[model samples]
Target: MKMVKLICVLATLLLPHLAQANPIRIKDLVEFDGVRSNDLVGYGLVVGLNGTGDGLRNSPFTEDILGNILERLGVNVTGEQFRPNNVAAVLVTGALPPFARTGSSLDVTVSAIGDASSLLGGTLIMTPLKAADGDIYAVAQGTIIAGGASAAGDGAAVIQGVPTAGVIPSGATIEREVAFDFSGLSTVRLALRTPDFTTAERIERAINAAFSRHVAVMLDAGTVELDIHATQMRSPAHALGRVENIMVEPERRARVVVDQRSGTIVMGEDVRISRVAVSQGNLTLRIQEAPLVSQPNPFAEGETVVVPRTDVDIIEEPGIGLAEVNGGTSLSEVVAGLNALGVAPRDMIDILKSIKASGALHAEFIVR
Candidate 1:
C-alpha cells in the first residue's frame, strides 16, 4: 500500500510536465501493411491532335503500331498506303490499388512521349493498360482536358503547364482484379515513416495504454507489432477501420531546414543553440566604363581616335555585432537571439549556417 501511495504521489508531481504536451491517440503515427497501391502503365495513341502528332518518318514505331492496330480491326493496307495528321502516341499510367475490381474507374494520366507539339483537344482511344506482369488490367478512353495552352508564331513559342500531360479522374475502367485476402492474417504491423526509438516506444505505450492491455508491442525502431485479440476486432476491415481513426501525436526531431533556391528557412520549436558568437559581413563589387573621343588636333591631319576609360571598386560591408546566442532555454530567448542580428531573413540563412558550423547550433541542419 505504501509503494502504491508513493507511485500515486509521483504521478501527481509529474502532472505539470504532462500538461504541456500530453500523449495523444495512437492511430496517426503508423501505416498498416499490405495497404498500398500498385502501378499500371501502357502505351497508347491519342487521336484528333490538330496537326501536331509525331511525324511518321521520325517515329517509324508509331506508324508500325498504327498499321498493326488497323490490321487487327479488319482494315488491311497490303499494297496501299495511309497517313494521318491526327494521332499522337501517348503513355497512359494509373494506380491499381489492392482489391481493385472490374467496372471500377481509376484516374489515368496521359503524357505525350513523342515529339508531338501539343496534346490539347485530343481524344484518347481505347488503350489497354497492363500491370508489371504484362497482364491487361484496364482500358482507358476519354477526351483529355489539358491543364494549359500552347501557341507558336514565326520565331517565338509560348507554353504553359504542359498541355501534353493530363489527368482523367475516374476515366479508366478496370478489366481485371488483383488478388488480396485481408482476413487471413493473425497479426498486422504498423510502420512509422521517420523511425525514432523514443517515438516508437511512446507509440507502443500509447497503444497498449489505450486498449488497457499489452496488445501492442514495440519490435524495432521502424515497426510496432499488434496482437489481434481483444484489442483488435475479429474482422480485418473493422480492425483497420478502428486503427486509422485514432489520432496519434507525431514526434519530430529538432531540426532546421533551409531551402537555398527559394530562400526559405524553417526551424522547429525545440531548436536550440549553445553559447557562441556570430558575425556576418557582405562584400559588394562595382564597375564603371566610359568611352572618350580624341579628335584630330585642329585639322592638323591627325587621325581621329577614341580612348576607353574604366573604374572598378570593391567595398566591404560592415559586420554585424558579435552577438552571443545561448542555449535556447525558452522560446523567447531563441527569438531574441535571432532578432538581435538585425539581418534580412534572407541574409539570416548565411548567418545561421555560420553559427551552426562554429559548433553553436544545438539542432540538426538540413539544406535543400
Candidate 2:
C-alpha cells in the first residue's frame, strides 16, 4: 500500500511538468542550410495505352515526338501520314534528394501534357531529366502505375482518381552528383521552419549547454549559426549529426484557427479568452408560387384567364439566451467555458468570431 501511494503521488507531481514542456528533436524542427532537394523535369512519351492516348490531330506535338523517336530507330518513313492511338506525350518530374550519389534511383511522376484520356498501363520511354541550370542530372523510364481508372459507354463515362497522372517507384537513375563541399565548411546554419525569437534563444542555449561551450549563436529569429571548429568534431557533418538529435523545447504563439467551410476549430494550448456573453439564432425566409387558370362557363366563353399567387413566410428560431463564458487561464478551461452554451460547431465558429471582434479572445484568430 505504501509503494502504490508513493507511485500515485509521484505521478500527480510529474503530470503538470510533463504537460507544460514537450521536447522535440532539433532535426524535426530545423532544416540544414545546404541540405535540400532539387527539382528535375523532362518531356517524355508514354506508349501502349488502351486507345486512350492523345489524338495526333489535336496534339500535333505528340506526332512530332513520335516521328523523332522513329527516325532515331532507323525507320525510314519520311512522308508517312500515320496516326496511332497507343501513344501519349507526358512531362516527367522528380526530386533529386540531398547527398544523392551517382547511380542512385529516384521515384518519378509521369503526367500527361496533351489531350490524352488516360495513362493507365502505359510505358514511359527513356527521358533525360534536367535541372534549373539546364544540365541533365538523371534519366527516367518505367511502366506507369496510374492512380485512377476510367470506363465509358456511348452516353456516359466514369473516372475514379486521376487517370492522367501516375508514379513509378525508383524509376530514375542519377547520372551526376551535385557539387557541394560539406567537409570543408567552417560554419553551418540551421534554418527554423517557423521563426520565433524565444524558440531561437532556447535552441541556442540548448546547443551551447550540450557542448559545454558557446558553439551556436542566434543570428535572428529564423537562423542559428553553428561554429563547427569549436565543437572539435571531425567535420561539419559530424557536428551537425550530433546537434540534430539534441532535444529542445520550442515556444509557439497562441492561435485559434477555424475553417468555415468544414466548421473546424483548432485552438493551441496557449489560447485564452476573457469573459464574454454570446447569443445566436437562425432566420429563414420561404417564398412559394402557385399559378391558377380559370375557364369561362365550361367553354361557353371563348377566352380563359390565368392568375398567379405567391405565399411568403418568415421564421425565426428560438435562440439560446445570452450565456456567460468566464475568463479562462488554461486551454481546457477555455474549451469548457465555450462548450457550456451547447451550440453546434458552425454556431460556435460565429461565436468565436464575435468574441474576437469584441477583444475578448486573447489569441490570433485565423479563418479559412
Candidate 3:
C-alpha cells in the first residue's frame, strides 16, 4: 500500500515533464516526394553446397538453368542426363536506393525456391536483377553467407535459425542509374509517415520559420508542399537540405495497443479514462478419475471386478468487488488507477475492453 502511494506521488510530480512533446527532425517524420527506393528481383542459382543442394529430379528447373549456364561457357549438355546435388535454384532480391549512380554496390538477399535442404557454403552465380519495368539494372554475384546451421544423425536432427536463406553484403553492382532530376524540380512535397493535421501544420510552420518566409504550405493532413524558388536556393536539393533538419514537435493520437499472444499492453501518454467501476475474478474446474478393483473374499472361486470412481469440483476464487477507478486527466494517473485494481496485465486487457464498451476509455483500443 505504501509503495503504491509512493509511485502515485512520483507520477504526479513528473506529470508536467511527461506532458511535454520533444522536438524531432523533419527528416525522421516525413519522406520526400520522388525520393524512394526501387525493388529489384531475379531468379538465380547457388552452387558448391556440401550435399545439401536440391535434387534435380524434384527441381528440374535447376537442371535446366545449370545446362544453360554451362552452355554459355561453351559446354553443351543438351542430350545428357545427369543429376547433381551441389546446386540449388534461388531468388535474389534487393533494393536500389534513390539517386544511386552507376557502378554503386548494393546488398542482396538469396532464398531457396526449391526442395534444397540447405544453402550452407554455397556461391551464387551471376544473376541479373530487374525492376518492375522489366529492365535489368544490376548484376548480383557473391558467396552466400547462410543464416543458420544444421546437423543430422540417422535417428534425429538438430537445426538452428534458417539455413536456406542468407544475405550478401555489397553483392550487387548497379549497371544503370534511375533517371531523376532532383535539381530541376520547382517544388517538393513532404509526405508524413503518420498523417496528422496538427503535425503537418507544425512542420509547415517550422519550415517557414527556418527561412523567415512563407515558403511551406500544408496541403493536407499528410502532405506539406515547399516552394524551392521562394527560398532563393539554387536548386530543390539545396532547399530540401535546409528544411529537412528543422525541428518540430509532432502530435500523436491517444492509443492503447494490446498484443493478445504476448499478453502485452502498451498505452500512449495521451490515453485517458473516465471514472468507472470494475470487477475481476477467475473460475477453475477440476476433474479426477480413480479406478477401484474388488476381489472375491478368500478367493472363493469368484472373478475379480473393477469399478470406476470420479471426482469433480468447481472453485471460484475471491476477486476485487465493485472497485471504483477515478477519472484520470493524465497518463500517470490513469496507470495508477488501473494498477489499484490489483489485476494481472492480461486481465487488465479484458477490463479495458469492457471499459471501452461502456464508453469510459477515452482513447482508441487496438488488439492484436
The prediction achieving the highest TM-score against the true structure is 2
Report, for all candidates in order, the number of backbone clashes.
0, 0, 0
Query: How high is the CA lDDT of each candidate model?
Result: 0.77, 0.90, 0.92
Which pairs of residues collide in model 1? none
Per-residue CA lDDT of model 1 for 13-132, tens digit only, reads 554574476445555567787777889998888888898788877776777778877888999876666677777888999999777778999999999877888888898888999988
> What is the lDDT for 333 in model 3?
82
Q: What TM-score would you give candidate 3 relative to the actual structure? A: 0.92
lDDT winner, 2 or 3: 3
Error of 1 at 146 (Å): 1.0
TM-score of each model, paired residue for residue: 0.87, 0.93, 0.92
Clashing pairs in 2: none
Residue-level lDDT of model 2, residues 1-368, one tens digit each, is 23223323444455477477799999999999999999999999999999999999999999999999989999976999999999999999999999999999999999999999999999999999999999999999999999999999999999999999999999999999999998999999999999999989999999999999999999999999999999999999899999999999998889989898977787777788998888888899999999898778864957877889999999998877888999988776777777777777888888889999999999999999
Model with the higher TM-score, candidate 1 or 3: 3
User: For model 3, how does the per-residue alpha-carbon lDDT over 256-330 read when each residue is reduced to its tens digit?
Assistant: 888878677777778899999998899999999998998998949889899989999999999888999999988
CA lDDT, candidate 3, residue 72: 98
